[model samples]
Target: MSKLIWKALLASPAILGAAVVAASPASAQQVSSTTVPSVSALEATGDGSTLSNLDQLNQYGREGRARRANSAEQVTSVSQLSDVQPTDWAFQALQSLVERYGCIAGYPDGTYKGNRAMTRYEFAAGLNACLDRIQELLVTNVADYATKADLEVLKKLQDMFKTELAALRGRVDTLEGRISYLEKTQFSTTTKLTGEAIMMLAGATSANLDDLGDAFSGNNGDDNQVVFQNRVRLNFNTSFSGKDLLITRLQVGNSKGFNGVAGETVLTNQVFGDTGNQFTLDTLQYQFPIGEKGRGYLMANAGVWDDISNTLNPYFEDYDGGRGSLSTFSQRSPIYRLGGGAGIGVKYDFSDNWQLSAGYLAGEAANPRSGDGVGEGGLFDGQFSAMAQLTYTNDAKTFGLGLTYNYSYFGEGEFGFDNAGFVSGFTGTLAANVLPQQDAVTSNSVGLQGYYQFSPKVALTGFVGYTGVDSKGGSFDDADIWYYALGLALPDLGKEGNLGGIFVGAQPYLTNIDGDDVKTDIPLQVEVFYKYAVNDWISITPGVIWQVNPNQDNDNDDVVIGTLRTTFVF
Candidate 1:
């Protein structure tokens, strides 16, 4: 009876599994980034024929093959899923498949993500993978197999889907024609364009301007007015070899941003600009493989440590502000605020669980007058930051640790310390603003950052950073700065595409200088934010930031900032 059923199913245009899996293109479904080749490797070949349609299938097949090759661990029971419970309606079925049939598999992180929807192509690929596993199982146990009656039922189901499969086949045929046409007419075979736009409404409040006597006090008006700003970015990514990438980015924004309403640098989003909304070429970088386990990058234009460093601040590292923490200080350590210009960086993966990275960047690699430029006073002669870091993690990537060291040198008037020097930058404009004594300063900074995800929904992340700067060749004093933060993140909060975060930490505050202990009146930053994904291409985020002493002075009023930001991406 099973043999008869199998025969009936086999006679259908396509089996039930095939009908379920072969209706759409595999490219339409999301796949693991590690299991597929680069986009350049999968570019369309200019072949205008029925076979063009098969190219997409071939790509999916390659991904499937990659997955199979890497899937060496066979799960024997659903109990292995730490998050799944017996209360689930499908728990028994899933257990049966894993323990009895060995067809289902979970991620290395021990997640099933059972609620994730799959397209026909993805389904097909999964089915094929399971069938291959079953084949191996049957070879090992010839006596245990689907009964004759079960085969007959499968045959009947296949026949029932015969009409649907035929219609799908017709659609596939038409898709082949369309694919061929697109291949022949598509622009730039090696480049793609992607863009993002953000619109934000923000306002700030300060209450202590009436009692200050300093030269810089009361300069910021009492106008607690709301402001509107927009930022636009266009990214051009290209590849000649599949293993290399070239990036060119264009950006423009008109936000007063963090320029402090009254001569201060307050908390603001990374995307906020202080350039009065002038368009600029923001980034020019090329990343290419150095070896099987090594990679290197070169930045010919705008770049920063954020472009090259393995910033361990995971929950708050969104420079785009469309994701993660909203405050720039919350994003990562100020130690990584190295200025950009011509630079080189490299990384090596010693093993699957450990890696090392190093980089150098010059803030002024191109000023050809006399004291600066990429030549005389450039990468090696002028302002620069050199950094190295080591990181370790398990295969699941649920926990990670990173240790980093950076040495920075800044010439006179080149004090680009990512504002870690709160009052340092403003002193030159103060009552006795003496031009900073025209000295060269060197800073040694160290940072330790780590994160642990207890589960998919919750995680803890934090970092501690310290920098000691010494003035050399001038009459200036030495200063030590410290900053740290601990944050709790709840992802998929209230909905699948939402996130909630709260963190409290100190921004870069001067602890000591010239053998004198600096008094910190209010040195903490408190922040909270919620991001709701409106859709695949849009998100709405509402955030608040409270700075106890924005300038580390009791005379200054506590600062409160609120923002409603909307982001669009494509």
Candidate 2:
């Protein structure tokens, strides 16, 4: 009789799984609240010391019902399961349990779910349902299990695990009480709130007075003074369906870019901008799955291309948040910033390693009356950008590459490249973006981005792009814009959660304008910074930027910027 019970214990795993141990990560219906045991660890037990699986079984051993309703039904025969097949490797073991003790149950959907991951509580629920049937089987057919004397040995088995079973019951009771208290006090069951705050002390100046020609030798605005600035963001994330998400964000800031100065191109701090310290709605986006392999996005406001697609540069891109690079140009390709406000996008996964994405956004989409003017709305008639991209990433995601194409259009008047094409508030320098007044502009751009991780602690990322701009509805001739960047990242530089980085790139510059000699030299930027995570809620990043030919003119002086930034997240 002892041998029979020991054999059941030894063979429990065969009934527990072969496919269960091999289930894919995608099969998890919900994220585990606690760390899950590794597959190898679950496979073999050299000793009975590891009680995780045993605890799982006994968690509901005393209860007559399962945690889920459908899991409580009886499985008198193996044929009752639709997914189980005669060819399955575990078929014989499963049949033995079903025909002998009739102790088995399927998932709520009436499937055995052998390829899905479940928590300890879920496994316990299934095991408890089987235990209930075992009790019934023993009462109805004692002759099959043991004689009358063997029945007394069952009492000894129960006594042997008394303390262990009692401890398991105590844990389950504690968990239930904690869950009840949380439900009574939670802010919202469907929504979660998070926030980030940043403060910076910064200064910028020309590298030398002698290098600056008379064209920019004097009248450097108040950009020279060291100043303090800050920005704060509050995010509310809601989910009605477990697979979908709705995001709403609010922001306020008091920082104005040094671009207001004479020789600067892009802002040194990506998170700081000219907000006048007035709080405003920053983002509203809803995302949900479409069938199985597709996803759709609806951005009502402040939406950019990267929001709908993954930036190939994994460690470098931060979704324009406070954790990564300090400058806007270093965050991602300028093509992603061509036009942004309201937009829609769709993405499909061709395979685990390949993806296709397409999206459109209009910068001036809020206006009701259209015709190349601000405060006038037209979903397709005004300033807009459309893009398509195909990307590939290896299974480990250590190597990634992407190819993208973009078409952007902007009418004259209050629109047309944000600053007469001399510079872009999003990215690029004055020399690269030149559009004559009252002239509409249209551009076709192609770009490629890639990254490789050759070492455990180091990685390399590179991006290059070209944009051909044509003057529409006006007199200016066509032009060309070119840019490239290379980056080196040192993860966990000094400690965990810390990053040290170096980037060298030419923030978009003009190569040709109506065949006119636009610039004699490249407008290059080199940056280095280290972000030190002080804790879960705080970090300090100090960095400097050096720009050659600061104003896109080779004759002008180089510029240097220094900044120390602190961030808090919660």
Candidate 3:
């Protein structure tokens, strides 16, 4: 499948996993004093702007003072009580402060000690720092304090600390409260919820015209057939958490056919209770943070999992289209398999715009139960599967590209063989020759898919896949199958409320077998769909499906099956 096709085929949600966790609050940087020119040099230059431009000069002076004030406010070293080398003392003291009170930025690696000697200038500067911080705290708590009173307290604190232990303990107490308040108000509460649904209708017709002529006689017959199927499904999802820190989804749907045929007879005539019926538990998954900075998350799911295909629209079951192509990747050709399973995955961002993921799955293959006569179960015999993918995104263009590979390995399974009949319960030699045979089988598959976005509103998508089978006793040689698809999508078309867009796609497939009787051919598939968003809780999708080849029989013309479908998501 192509990237445009995938985005056009299914509704996608923004991924908010580890990306949120890895983000950190922006920090303020210190303005170094070295960048400021000396006061004597400025005065000596006597720039004319100094006096006539005193106002502008005053603004610069005020900015410089503010920078100095900021530095002074955080300085809390107590050099007077130390007797160690200045550099060593400063490093150790800074480390100790960070460890004890969690105050003052410590050494780059984090360490601190108290055995530091004090210098008059250093002591004066440190004491002034404590006083500055004390004023800042007072302003935060007592916003209405008179200017005179505020200044008086500031001066008193500076005078006392400068002569005492060269630090103001009372001022430290006040600063802690301001830091606590800032932390408390740093984050705001926000929530977001998104939902989608689809409804569809389709019709199909098949015609076979043939003629026969012989030297002596001629005979011929013409067959024309039409089949109609209708299905409706509804899926619902609800999620809540800060920036997707936590997520939950729920899905449900029901489907039924209007007019159809199971085999050679009219499906409506089948006395069965429900000739065409289907239901699904589409998706249920949870995502949560795994490490600091939310570099990634741990995701788990239990429900109908969509195959990792590159195409915009899936090949197996178009929940929105009643009649869609059955994926060869599934157990068989005629049925859409839906089963339960559990799996874990991790998505990590290697850079601002790139990410990768790996996941594993284990459970019953979503095909008919093994032991059935259908040849479908050969590849799904209690198998295990794994997948890896990498993606690159450009936020400015709302575009992304991805590459993926998937593999599955099945355990030993039975293989069946058909033989010309002799009779039941016949003699040993004759019986062995008459009855059909069965044996164990194993199979494997590999696939590659890619996606590209042309713009935020449009995308191109497609993918190719291959599978191989191995059997015991050489009853049959290995067989290979391949599929390719391309599609286009229009997002938020017409900007209608709750309405997504429509998409059309086509896929072609081919298969070959290396055995006593060789066979090869290609099948053509097409689909057209309209998706409508009813609201936050529901979306409707209606679509059509056309298969140009039901069987690879070159002697027979193509057969087409029509279907009508509807899906709702909450």
RMSD of each: 15.3, 14.5, 21.0
Instruction: Tell how far residue 74 is off in model 1, in angstroms.
Output: 27
What's the residue-level lDDT of 336 in candidate 2?
68
How many residue pairs of model 1 clash at the backbone? 5
Ranking by lDDT: 2, 1, 3
- Alpha-carbon error at 546 in model 1, in Å? 1.0
Per-model lDDT: 0.60, 0.64, 0.34
Q: Can you write out model 2's per-residue Cα lDDT over 185-260, one digit (the tens) per residue?
A: 9866789899988888887774343332232123334436677988888999998788888999998888766643
The local lDDT score (0 to 100) that residue 129 gets in candidate 3 is 35
Better by lDDT, candidate 3 or 1: 1
TM-score of each: 0.63, 0.66, 0.44
Per lDDT, the best of the predicted structures is 2
lDDT by residue for model 1 (1-570), tens: 122322332233233233223322352232122222211222222233435444443443332222222333545355654333456533443455446556666553333432122122332222233344444544464555433322233333333323322233434457668988989997657898988888888887754544332422324455566888788888999988888999998888886544332323333433335446677887899999988999999998866676776777666677535567777667777667644467899999999989999888876676544563122365567777788989998799989888989888776645544422212332111111111435667788899988898899898889888877787865546766777889888889998878899988876666554422234443577889999999888989899988776555556577788988888988
* Local accuracy of candidate 3 as per-residue lDDT tens digits, 1-570: 122322211111111111111121121111111111222332343443323333432332222122121121223343322322346634343334333333232121111121112232233333233333333444464543223323333233323222222121222345668878976995433423444333334344542312111210212223333333333333332234443443343323222222211121112111111323544343445555555423333334432223322122322224323222221221111101112244556666677676676665534434456643322332245444555666666665345555555554333332111000101110011111111134333434444444466666665555555545554546555555454555555555555422232222222222343332222334445545455555544445454544443222233344453433343433
**What TM-score does candidate 1 get on C-alpha atoms?**
0.63
Clashes of 2: 7
Off by over 4 Å in 2: 1-188, 206-222, 259-265, 268-272, 375-377, 413-424, 514-520
Per candidate, the number of residue pairs that clash is: 5, 7, 52
Query: Best by TM-score, which number?
Result: 2
